[model samples]
Target: MNAVLRVAALGLGQLVAIGLLLFVSAGTVDYWQAWLFLAVFAVTAWLPSIYLQITNPVVLQRRMKSGPVAEGRTVQKIVMLGLYGSLVAICVVGGLDHRFGWSAVPAALCVIGSALAGAGLVVTVLVAIQNTYASTTVRVEAGQHVVSTGLYGLVRHPMYTGNVLILVGLPLAVGSFWALAFVMPGIAVLATRIHDEEKLLGDELDGYREYTQKVRSRLIPYMW
Candidate 1:
């Protein structure tokens, strides 16, 4: 299949799946917050893919080949599973929170969450534009080198930084404080994945070790 077509299919499928998960768990279509969250998510998620497809098809192609099955390392596979599971859990819990009125998140907070999520999406897109070798799966591809400019200069794993924001912001955007509880596990999994990825990059990719030293941060600046 063509990479563009594959990416489109995968993106559409994921969008539908998330919609179903949220609505089905919510047991009603009257959830305005869920609708708003989905709209924001769809735009942020798909627009970046389209941009990447136009500017860097290789990155999009690599991203399409993601999830646990695409991971070569056992630890990476486990991390991917945990990450995906947490994402699903967040959606489900958010929906359930709405169904049961678990928590009443303010409209202002929902707007803030949407903004944070959008910012994270932009950050991820910027990372992809700057680092052509930014594959979703953790592996040092052929001719792949450490990227230390732009966002990479700020942190060794800017992509993961974006991911953390998205994971944390999504639940709040959906108006589910209960769903926010799942974000921590996803972050822990991401941190573990980053650790393993750094080990691999340091061992296989040249100059990665020096890049880490120069950057001095993995996902956050002035901390960690």
Candidate 2:
């Protein structure tokens, strides 16, 4: 019960932190686009976390220990730092764009972006549901095995695919086309992390090499 409460509090803290970053950087609370984006993001991100907490507490517990400090490998620590920095830049840049009138995204496009973000988060939750060992850090846990069914069958790194969508969608949802530039760094970090993670998985985890052969793609199908 305490673990569940801690997870809930942490989730709420992150949400509030993001909101503060957006509004504080924007210099005002009049940004309706940011509000709508936050609403969509909060629902899509939090509800699934709550459900996962109930259904798969172990994965949730593992995920709770995230960010660079939780990463075991030095390379993964760097990758996580880069990834987190880029995510922060996305929010900060988006808010600044709003404050300076840098980009005038249409309401329809913002709605589309919200949908994309929501869908991406849902994909991440589904991946967690299908794979019990989907920890936030890039490490194989004790008793971990290759997950080749469901989303894993579609792509070796479905979670990263979902992250890519979220990164792309965040700025547009906040009505800042200029902020989309920040997404590239996050994607690049994800790619680097994937390369390192796959190498580790192939060498350390049993059957992972064969599963990689069967999956064939990391983030996308037929093209990657």
State in Å the error of residue 223, model 1. Answer: 1.2
Candidate that would win on lDDT? 2
Q: Residues 143-163, candidate 1: write the lDDT tens digits.
A: 887788999888899989998
Q: Best candidate, TM-score-wise? A: 2
How far does residue 214 in candidate 1 sit from its true spot (Å)?
0.7
lDDT score for candidate 2 against the true structure:
0.86
Local error of candidate 1 at 34, Å? 1.4
In model 2, what is the error at residue 164, expressed in angstroms? Answer: 0.3
lDDT (CA) per prediction: 0.85, 0.86
**lDDT of residue 162 for candidate 1:** 93
Quote model 2's TM-score: 0.96
